[model samples]
Target: MSGIQYLVCLWILLITQSRFVRSDIQFIEKHEGDSVVFPCAIEQRNPAPFGVYLKRSWLVPNEILFMHTGEDFKMKYDHDKSRTIVSGDPINHTLNVTISELTTKDTDRYYCEFIVENPSSEDEHIPGKTEFFLLVTADTPASVDSGRIETCSGGSVVLPCLPAEEGLAVEGVSLKRQKGQEPVEVLYDSRRHHGNEPPSYSQFPAERFRLTSALGPGGITYNLTLQQLQPEDSALYSCQLLQRDRPDSHASLGRRALFVSVKGDDCSCSSSSTLLYALSSAVVVLLLTIVFVGICLCKLRPSVKPNRQAPIYEDMAGFKDLKSSTKLAPNHLEDTVSVYNNTSVKKSCPENHYESPTGALCPRNETQT
Candidate 1:
């Protein structure tokens, strides 16, 4: 076969495989910090399938989460060991896997395959395969609208937790501090214990956190007092209350969150410096605008050029006579004559020629010579 024929066959195979994969894919959406369960069913056979494989699909390589062979099961990844569980029932021909505490980073596609022995030959084949696309969205913090408090460093502040219903008896209370993506549990107070165990809160310092109960207008309020506050203490604090009547209910009875801001000693100075910087920027911008306008006006103004042409004498007749006389006696005069100025013309001309009021040289009427 030619190379062209091989290329065409490969392209057709890829398109066919892509369509088959798309048909088998299932999409699931959940919020962050939630749990998800995936169920896989296998074909009923005389002997159960040899093994099962659960993998997280990627562009180049796939991550193997669970691998089962006969009656043995193994979890391949250490990070998911505590959060992932896989169980299979040969009699029911079913496989189930559960993952808890999911984050946005866990959003990806997964593949589940069942391996079986081929009846005709001594080879293993995949009898069934399934694909899942898990989408984990960011979960917004709960109860941020309760209240906010601001305090300076080295001071103490109180965060209030109010009950959701007016008269429900509170069973347990927990406080968590949300800084970045994760919430750190600061305190947990369990009034009564049920079948399930409460969440642990051993990571934070016990001396710095205190949970106290107080009677207010509301039935009861739980206040979390944080002592010796530092700048790092500024964060969103969430309070959760579990009521005694709802032991089976997994949801909290009420959730309240408060924002706290711990300022440093130089906070005021920093704010003043920022204000001064803004004012300086405004002044600079105003000055630049004024200079630009002045430049534009100067360019647009009309230029007044000096009058280079000689000034015109008021008396044209006398000027004409003077010019004619000068032309007639050009060879007699050694010095250049000034016709416009009366004093200059008098020095060169006869005494009978006097200046008129209009500054024109005129000769008085001469008697009979």
Candidate 2:
């Protein structure tokens, strides 16, 4: 056959054998191994299509996981093939996905599209289109609502996870540490024993760590305490909802990655220091408040008050006694002073010492003192 005939035949073969459809995870929920349905509507939600193919590309990670284009491609990505199972007859166009084992390295923006016909060399060949973001969180010091991660070589590290919302009856909790390709389970709890639940406990993954339930102010808080942490413990930690059905971690809600710089043999945290700092801050604030109050008092002046020592010299009130030789008394007057001078004044020179009219001494006899 001529090259042209051969090329045309190959195109026809791929397009015919390989069907295409669309798929994508709904919701913006970001996590690893989250099952998101990639819709492959046959005719924009009408009748499902007859041909379907699943192809996904991760831009940030720069990896392409396309459907096996050929037998060689299938062999290279066989695991992916088994992991990916489709539902709904292609003739009807519906697909569901279940990615079991998820990793932190799965952080990437994904696009899943289908081809109506391969090598169509035409516009109608493109099938369905959808995309999703998978933020594969690390499994290190895991918590539902991860707060902060701090680590020292042989010291202590605390990983706090905050749940999406409060009031979730977390039945059990588990913490897993992933180093290289190996995941070491550090903490496990069989029963949270919240409300009226009974307590359950066990041992696994040696004795590096243990999970315990404690009644905290934060409400039945679950904790995984590790003593004498090892250097190899440094890894991406994750907290998973403890479940027995699949006996596998559900989805990780929180994560943190940290490097430990071990120094000597001291691996314990200094809660005392934190407390001391807090106490000192409180004391300083209290002192400042007291000082502020004192300053305000000092700056505020008092209004002037009437003096009790001042004599009450008021004018005589109305309806005074005007006849008697006695002076009139005021009804409300506290005190009265009307003094009468005994010494009398004489004219400059009483004329020739006029006969005394019960009064004057002549100036001739009077001396100006």
Candidate 3:
């Protein structure tokens, strides 16, 4: 009876020791638009996967982000379905989740819970939980030494303000401009909007200013991006962090003096790619024109030297010349003779001689008798 009681007590002690282990809280920081992996493991060697869940503190009521059964893994959130991936071999008893394209809102404490089928009882399972903290921050972190941002006019610049502490929750942020002696509130956001809508801005033009916050290794850092920058936009700027339920508790997170210089859109301001494209296009056109002209010259060269033939003359019977017996009359005498002959035939009938058909002399009628 004493040995039986001792064996039962030893079995109970072993079960309690196995269930009391807690995972260490891991601190991780990732840049926006990046990816991160959460690691989880069960103390039981080669534990059978019954069910697994991942939850967050900010997501109240239904905080489950992902779940896994012995068959497959599934996600409860709409956005998580696309970006979440469960990667780990079940044989290794590791439950690892990888999430891609991390945003500022992804910064939170994540808890991973695993359920295994109970060995002692049928239709029952035991659960264990572990936690990890993730901080999603921007690629460009704010510097504490100097707060100065430089940009050209008509462009945009992000004024950075990173908190010095780590894992601190951000309640609200306000951006201010200090010019001369007075400070003007450029934008103020309380982070209390619905449907994932961004925070609201104050008196300043809402379109020109945007509020951005990210989780960093230090803490929650807020930033502001000024759009359509102008020379007048250059001034001393500062961003303050507000405590929850304490509107007056405006803590100075960072200060940045913006220097926006006028950017002229002149010929020299053209991008290198545009200039290179223009030059390449011009060169291609010039080469094409030269090739076309060369082809035309090659095609026309054969026609330049024309084929020639010698002239031919043919004689006619009437144009044959015959030798004349009488002396040839001069051009002036021939003209006078032609005029005299033409007068002899006019109006008066000559009694001496009638003109022959060839315009030569002929005998009169009395001589013929």
Candidate 4:
């Protein structure tokens, strides 16, 4: 081949051999004393790959945590050897590194690299790589005394933002919410300004979050109000007070933390109240039913009317023959005479013997004697 054609052919070969691929960044968040696993996938190749490496890439000199060579695995750092484990599965084409008992110092960006020997050149080429960022947060003593608020969905609630230490001049306030894996900035208000300049205010969602301040005897009280709450709004809210250290500098004066719990609209208390109302209505209905039944029974029953007329003695002589009857004779005779003389019965018996001048017991007895 000619010298120029050989140079062109070699250039084409190098261009075809060297290739690069970049993946999107992944972010992870965790608490202190927790464990995390970084799973890296091995690129499939015809021959078994040469080696793998896990390193912290954000530092000036990349720190290698784990390395895999031909049939062997090792940890480079002595401090990490106790808490880190590196393993790989050749068949599944995966390399996994796990770190336990993590601390805030372990928070950094990491990358996994897979190297393969290039047959054409002496150098090794990275065929596969992945990167991720991890964040670890530690709990402070003040978090133990954080305030907690609970509210229902679609309702509004206010989170108080008072200085931890009193009598400090606060120039600004910032509120943040920590949900699952990220801390979101809710709002910020700057109270400091130059002459004739207005204060500054900013918020993530202006419609949902509002920051209001009130002047009181103690100092200015800043409150953050959340409207139309949802389940996702339940989170740990942090408030920081900013004070002007100098004309061009500001520092945090104090921090206060609050946790909020948002429930569904049909909360337990509302359900209980509804149940109690239903029971009360049922009781009232039952009482009304009983009263109605009693009234029906009273109206439906048959009534008895007194006769009002005295019963006349059929055998006056028989009554006089008995000794016990003699004592009742006067009252009985007076009752009989009063009944016989009644205007209502006088028409039927116009002249009764009890009312006769001859004093005969009865007309039939007088005729017989």
Candidate 5:
């Protein structure tokens, strides 16, 4: 046989085999924290072994859920491994997934893919995909609308989750804290044998969390009253409906969260803006006080008085007397020495000299000497 002929025969056989396989979708309706299963089937005439891959998607494809070779089945997304269960064999050509502890974020489309590698072919693996859409309904009626609730410390507030559905009897409800992707801290359960609290709620304030049944527009509304609200009481609270017969069934009707920004009563921490304002005011007052004290000190300080000067005429008279006294001292010594030596002396005074009242050298005579 020729090589071209063998390739043509293989191509025809693969085309014929691909026509026999088909994928199908299954629908599911569940509530939060309830386990739900999805079934996918692939039927073919040839029961040859194939690989299987499962993935979940919202608007875009997300994490891989399960992957199967001919012998082993492995969970591709390890974080969600504990919650996902996959079963069925290649011979059965079916895949079933049971997802436990569902949340609102889990509502998405799941894809079951069957892949086959053609014999002796290095090309891309042939894939066939089946899609399943999951619809998770809230346990409460759709009309009840409440989001985040804010309250102050030492005050009382109500977190209401009213079911608007008129005919459905209220079997039970579970109130819990939504811990990220799952629920944590069971606050209340109507189905529990010991009132509404579980053993996990021993540390929780039993008296502060009260259940109130009242009549509203939808007839009877259930509210969880929170008293003595502190900052620590802030969290996302979930109100889930429980089935009487199937006590394991948990679904959220609505969520009411608390944002406790209390003013006082142990919540004494002030806002950042208030702290900034106080610090700024203190700084301004300190600067102003310093300036005022400096001004007062300057005003109260003693002044330095300068020494007074003599009158101009008195100063001139004193200068003239100082000169005359200095000159007369020398002249008197000279006259004494002349008399002792017995010298015949001429008049010591110049011919044109005159004495003024101050007795200083006058340069020339005012009157004749």
Candidate 6:
């Protein structure tokens, strides 16, 4: 029995030493028409993140105005069922956000938290905290600017939600639905508005909306997965914060406007690609012009000769002949080194020699013949 108890205790110690930890995230700041990356990571090996939560609220002007999670949509007046959704890839562990037509009331501090189940704990799980900040502002539409655009119908956009404070640790992010609709019936979802282009414009896009707390790095996130994009999904979207007891007033978190610009069939297709196309064309034209000029010069060049002597090729035999001719010069020809004697002493041609005043032998047979 004692040995059995010791084994159990040893087993417990081993388990304690190998405890598994949950995931975390890195926060980022992004405005409308811009881009942001919400990080979510796991400390344990292959710990499955089945669910995530994210929440946003008004900060300065009015606190806790409105909010949303992946589920539940509520406003002061009624339930808004078609405006929010979560659009991140759990497998890739990235939380991408986008805010369509922003309004002034969407400015506020955002929060996010992730939960993990601890099998060994009494509660069967532990709620892990996620830290992040959100600053929802009104900016230009990214679909039209240098921004990378994505199309979605219904509720399928990862809106970048900004929290009032940065890095505030929280247990779990809640998705509270809010009600805020346009009484005038905004123009965005309409089949007729689609025009003759491949992309159609439709009015009355989403049927409802909701919000939730994300695992890490929080901000405005998605709630609905749009089946398809329609002309109705073209208008601006507002991410309002939910209050503590009574959600913030629609007037509290000012609205942000995002002008829905489409890739119409006539947004200037003549220019096709970017300015790089023109630059490449210009380079090709310049090279061709240079080649043509070179060809013309080569064909029109005039013939001419260089004012210099050509090279001479000789060997020892040629050198010997030159030397003999120079030495055997005729008597009348002063081709050799001039002998400057003061007295003309006519000496006899003794054999093949001529005696001079200096008593030097001369090649008389070879010269003066």
Task: Give each model a TM-score.
Answer: 0.31, 0.27, 0.34, 0.37, 0.32, 0.23
- Model 6 / residue 308 / CA error / Å: 11
lDDT of 3 by residue, 215-334 (tens): 667555677777887656655566665545444322332434332233345313445435655565576556666767887888887666667754433233223222111222242253
Better of 2 and 5 by TM-score: 5
Better structure of 2 and 5 per lDDT: 5
Show pairs that collide, candidate 5. Answer: 32-251, 139-253, 140-253
Clashing pairs for model 3 are 165-218, 166-218
Better structure of 5 and 6 per TM-score: 5
List the lowest-lDDT window of 10 residues for candidate 3. Answer: 320-329
How good is model 1 by TM-score? 0.31
Residues 68-98 of candidate 2 have per-residue lDDT tens digits of 2221222125665555555444444445444
Models sorted by TM-score, best on top: 4, 3, 5, 1, 2, 6
lDDT tens readout by residue for model 5, 1-369: 654455456545554643333344445546677888767566573634366666675433675654555565677667777888777764466767788988667755577666655567652333344666554444544432334454667777776654424466665556655423444645645544534535234235787777778776857777777688665555456564444444433333344433222335422333443465556557655666676788789999999998998899999878876776676766556534356668666344532224443334535345445
- lDDT (tens digit, per residue) of candidate 6 on 1-369: 554455456545544554233233223334554433334333443454434444453333222212223433233333322333346543333343333333434433344433444567632222334433343343343411211223433224443333323444322121221223221222222122223432222233444332344564444332322234443344344332222333223222223222322223322342343343555556555666676788789899997887875445556557755755565445425333435755454543332323342224645445457
Model 6 RMSD in Å is: 25.6
- The number of clashing residue pairs in each candidate reads 0, 24, 2, 0, 3, 92
RMSD of 1: 21.5
In candidate 5 the C-alpha lDDT for residue 182 amounts to 45
Global CA lDDT computed for model 1:
0.61
**Candidate 2: where are CA atoms >4 Å away?**
1-39, 45-50, 59-76, 117-129, 140-369
